[model samples]
Target: MAKLWILLLLVCVFAGAQPPERSKAPKVWDEKALAEWATPIAGLNVRPSHIRPKEYYDLPVVSLRTYPVYAPGREPAGYWQRIQSTGPKPLMEKKGSRTATEWIEAGKIAFEEADFFHLRTLDPKYIAEVRNGSLAPSRVLPDGTLFGLRWVPTKQGVALSSSNCSFCHTLYLPDGARVPGAPFRTIAPRPPETFKVWPVFSRLQVELGVLVGSPPFLMPGLSVGARLSQGYGVPWKSDDPHERLKTVTQEEYEQLDLAARSSGGLPRWNGSIIFPAKTPDLIGIQERRYIDHTATHLHRNAGDLMRYAALVTSAEATRFGPHEMGGPDTKRIRARFSDDDLYALARYLYSLTPPANPNPFNESAAAGQRLFQREGCVNCHTPPLYTNNRLTLASGFAVPANAPASLEILPVSVGTDPSLALSTRKGTGYYKIPSLKGVWYRGRYLHDGSLASLEEMFDPSRLQDSHSPGGWRPLGTKTRAVKGHEFGLGLTPAERSQLIAFLRTL
Candidate 1:
């Protein structure tokens, strides 16, 4: 009996000592693989011009101290200097061979650390001062850790401070709960004075001969400032150089101003042709077959998301490049980041889940769910993932006959604004039908963010030229009509309320 027990114990020990089964690693793509995988569902007939070789121009050597800066509630310069004296810690810690789960973990870190927008305009000292608590607690969560911004270590101690994808996507609730992959709701419109700062800086840069060009002029910044100022009910200065350099015509600006005031919110970008944009929630993005408001990029798989991340980050300079181009350009960048990094990032993004809804379905919400299907909302915002993952043509965009069927262009127009699909670099002559999941947490509805709430969307007064009694009015204009997506305007007040309740449950 003792010998038999001993034999069984030995067998157990040997089994435990053997290596555990390992999960398969996520697939990493090489350049060739990525190109083949991302082959446009439809071949693009309208190819952009070939990039010319970069010309080296002499840039002015300017002292950092000469720059005038302002951060509303920042600490004195000496405090920042003191912190900088201590070397910055590395943003990412080293890890071993990455499994699928490990890739997700690494991807989360990358999402927080990566700077895709190239918005490194602020002095590092200012960022440090503001982050260290001179500014409001808007960016900090209940845990006392920062949410969107981070101070990364550079070779010259800790000079780089950047905003990542989380800056716009992460939402901090009113009760101090922090939710990742949610659309930001607390962002207040920038004051007119705040908009004035960047133009001053850009003018200085041009005067110092630091930047010499026309197409790449700091127009994006200037446009944003003008849009913000107009949204804030501030008068536009006709003689302002920033206003004069704008791509948007005076009539377009007037329409934008009217739209902003009517919605009581900022207007989203009319493609790149206008200013501002609706910040999209990142939850459940993995299921999306297309990306961007205009559905410019058909997301066949995770690699597409990684390509986007690369284009937005350190590789942004290559967007309209003379040499290496990775994004929309024909040529690829000279130095490409490892496919593993993007794979990890995509895995992490795919892992994100929406926060659990505190509100459960009630009798009214159940009725609303039935209405949701009956009202034709289910056609575009389909069930399960809540999107058909197809593109709808803008009201006026004429689809080319040679356009490939793989592009999945729908014949119907939802009557939404067509400018974003017609005018911007991202315009594909179609607008992607957006998923309705998490619509409850989102605000300033529609592609342009022209409506502030779901209730406001059904308001009949929105279709009229004059402001409605209880409806939201744009900041500057008295008589502005909010048109498009007029599906549920006929719903009774109680039905609308119930529908909104059901939407929150999504």
Candidate 2:
């Protein structure tokens, strides 16, 4: 056999002279090595390779990813701009140094004494003693006593680790004073005096209320309805076709279209819009690098809050809920946060910002901002801060051939609408590209609020195909189905009210 063909041509010339297999690849960690490994844990660090997760979640993700890209108001001429060019306290504070106005009045008196709702009590036997790990969700002291007198640290019932932003952004501390809650009304219920839950607007619910100072029409839907009630560990059986979904029966809507054409329907979240879904306002989320609302983890701060407090809390929070975090003061609220109060509540939520640019250039919003950049939409809406943040796929989404290798996916640019990621429960068509900057009071919009306004989002008969709860729906004649970034479609009705007067000045 020709000596086995001369030993297979000398093993194919020693595998093509050996030098070509050098691409062991895998190095992609840009932004100058993630700003030198996030400068000692992101205290104003920024370097996710100098912007582009839609400008690093609409700007300032740790001083623009760990400093040095100056320009827009440069930053050199000294004395911190001659002490902020003679300031009164807004060169990022320090004029009269009342020690940064006494840590902003001791963070508004520790956000009004940890928003004291009788210091924390949900009791329906604390959801079956957090599903039998045996009762524990502490922080009590207004007489009912408990602020660490102990219990809550279960391993598979829920709550063993918490940097405590009111155990997942639902704060109010009323008799204590912090206010903000809406997501499926955990209480505080009573605000609809014309409080539009939708009617149009969503560049990701106004970039998640400009990266988390959120208020005007709040969001975070009770921490995504406490992450779908701790990832559906109970509820569901109202007759089970995924919780008796409002009057089915056409043979259970043909067995929910054969269970959404087999295996990709119930990861869920729109629980009547997560019981009102609000409470997120972690005062500018560590200078907005990104977290949830599908913006996943692009350069997130606090090591993505210690990987969502070790995967959203103890005993691997049962792979994210349906029970875990032990009960009975789970070892005294894990000894009342001492990692310097979890880096001072992530440095008071990365020093929150947003109350400044209240409507800067309006000539009927500059003719609806030249018909919103002559309708090509400045290519994913670019500007000082309109949105180029990046993540596409809204048109007719269908990418899920079993996604989740920790979802590094992308690709959906051709006119986005994808019938609610092929009809919901997060059917992985990938999302995240958000940010527009407080579109004049954020309201119900996509990521499942469905659409509500911006003039029914340019009504081309609400994008046909018989609109059901499929996607865009929000405002009334009741069929919303519209999906991702479809910016002011085919205008004209005074250019959709001058692009809603240039999105009410962002």
Candidate 3:
């Protein structure tokens, strides 16, 4: 028995304790691969260009750790004083990342730690304003940290910065729990009026606008009208709406933006202010076949996700054919994450879990499930992951003979408005049929987020111009018809309720 016990001890000691080995990550910034990754836009038939791999990799890798911003009076004692004096600190080193679990943890740190805009506030007065509740990003974490803001200590001073992924992607529930990778509810961005007391932070906001709100502008020196002109126009296409931006003054541009920039939709780089895309929920991005609403890029693997992270952050070429948006003065300083950091971020994003469904799959949901099948929703939504994972053509686009065979294009358009699919810099003339796996948790509906609720989506009244949309609308739009996706509209009130109940349970 002593010998047997000794043998068992030896067996336990020698056996390995680790997860299954991870495959070597593919090289994400391959020029040849990037050239072929995106689907070309419809009318112009030109693919959005990307910067050379050298341009991407040459940027300095900054992996500084970010600190949480506490609401007024809620921060731990001495948190403010300690952080103010400290210099920037690196979040992690590659030497410590051996196992998948370790890499994922590092990735989470990288995700939460990286900051885009460094609003330098050298004086103690800036901190006082933050603590006094005069200035704070709206969404608050349960611990009282502002969800969208981070305090980043630099060599000069503590700067206010936006948290990397969590700023836009995190969803806060009524119970005070946070769901990472869920879509964020936007609080109206603070107008410049609030920034009068903090001049440094306000100036930084203008400089940072080149990276955040108006990233498509290659040069920061141009007037708002010129920047707008260069930022969003499809040069090759004669009918591009962005052409008008060249003639507008700064005040005119502001007026246009005031109306175009709605709550659910904000114009992104290569995205149109007139046809802004809604923020996507990143919870199940691993299961997706394409990226973006227009199926702009193929989601080939983790490498692709990493490449996307790089492209969005700093690598965009802004070169569609011969046109360079910023002209010759496009040079600027930009930050990058190491390839390993990006790989870990992709892995962490893939690992995001959907929250448990509070809606029980009882009789009502079951009946709705039957109705779902009877209405043939199964053809598109499917089961399990709840998406068919196919691309559907927009109303105006005709599939070209050269369309990649790899994409499962469902030739028929859903008859939805085709403006976003046809007009934007990112437009590819197709919209991926979205998955309904977490429909219950999604606060907005439609690619542009025109509807606020599932109930609002099913209401036939929404098709009329008199209907007041429950969600986002263009600036001047008080009432406008929300068209298309006419499915499930014919169902009775009780039937629609049942269907919604079943959808929530998903």
Candidate 4:
């Protein structure tokens, strides 16, 4: 009995219970939350409003887990029959009395098992095809479950959910280990070369404009023009590159996706195909002050985190200023997550820890640590959390003198690509200074994921026009300069090695 009690105590410590952090769990779908759900688009400084609470609560609640998808021949005997016979599983139920550790455990399950808001489907055939890219037996986890695809049960029926936080956040190491919440992992089966992805995955209402780059307000069928306009068009910018998407052919759209995919970037809604932002590492998200590469939302508290999940999932607003994204189709509230479910998710995200650091603190790393300090990388990326949690200006962006005091701005430009800052709907005129806590696990760098490695990031050759990008660039393009964030480019080969050694240890 004492040992069992000790084991329970250890579990709570690992969970990092912080009940006081959230004064009291706020009703996630409250009118007050909807009001401040979105931080306005940066330059225009206009917040996009969302659907009313009545509309949000009117939708059905989802608390189901998707069954694990195994490889083609790896399924246990009678497993399919067992899962099919099983009824809907209510994943999280609010209990009158429960420990904080219990809440976090529930959140962890939802984080890994919950189907993405925009990617659920009842089709069985398409679920099997989601693993087409991973034909080898070695591609799956130790338990033989495929990385992302799952068979989720809903009131409608047994459905194959396409993506989850694990889809983008998991780094599938070659040795069969996965680091959940690490950046730049694409486990979803790629759309066909023709760019005609699983059309069945998105039934009329089973998608989000921000998530899949389709039109938000799809009433009848929409043209690629309407889809692109809703997903990437900035009516505020007269010379918006997305305006040309109206005339863009299917082949052209395919090329754009391929280009973005090659470098581990995707043009999410309100973001641009030409200026895609990299998927963020969620391992240390609890320490972050802002969300999105452009700092479009403030990470004030657990309620805000809960709201973010709800926003990206189903409540995204497509309107800005006087311009409407979809002329014919009105904005719709697709689905909603319960307050307890979202709160659980927030706690789970907060409790995530980095995988064990393989790189040791050696003499080289110690010298490199000194170099890191001397180089003044600490101003933006302060230690402990390894980030000051402030927003830095991008070049060519005029900082509004009357900007809100709540926004902590460093006013220093790294001179990176400002297109994601200026042209996209997510543009906040500032980029959130990212933490360097787990760069060793992070395979990609920069706002657009332009570099593939720390060695490549500091390579002066990357600044030259003839240099090839180690990471993703345009599909067929050969060479282009990866400009900006020129720090550590002047280091000698030995010093560079030491610097990277120190960075990996973090």
The candidate that achieves the highest lDDT relative to the unseen native structure: 3
Residue pairs with clashing backbones, model 3: 259-475
User: Of the candidates shown, which would achieve the greatest TM-score relative to the real structure?
Assistant: 3
| Candidate 2: tens digits of C-alpha lDDT, residues 168-227 | 343323343322221211112222211121111112323222111111122233333232
Comparison by TM-score, 1 against 2, better one: 1
Instruction: Score each candidate by Cα lDDT.
Output: 0.52, 0.34, 0.73, 0.73
Model 3 residue 427 distance off true place after TM-score fit, in angstroms:
0.3
Give all TM-scores, in the order shown. 0.68, 0.26, 0.89, 0.87
- lDDT by residue (368-406, candidate 3, tens digit) is 999999998888888987889999888889998887776
Query: Sorted by lDDT, highest first, which candidate order results?
Result: 3, 4, 1, 2
What's the ranking of the predictions by TM-score, best on top? 3, 4, 1, 2
TM-score of 1: 0.68
lDDT of 1 by residue, 1-506 (tens): 99999999999999999765434323333344233322121113342222221210111111111111224334355744655565533323443465566778777766665542223334654554554545442433444443344444344444333344665566666666667777665433321222222332233333322221111222232343343222121112233222432355445554444343332222322223132346677888999887777665557778678766544332333221122222132222133234455666787889998877776799889988988988989988889988898888878766787665557767888887665555443456677888888877676577766666777777767887764423233334455676778877789889988888888788
Clashing pairs in 4: 263-472
RMSDs, each prediction? 8.7, 25.9, 3.7, 5.5
Q: What is the lDDT of candidate 3?
A: 0.73
Question: Residue 43, candidate 1: how far off, in angstroms?
Answer: 15
Q: Model 3 residue 487 lDDT?
A: 85
Residue 175 deviation, candidate 1, in Å? 1.8
CA error at residue 502 for candidate 4, angstroms: 0.5
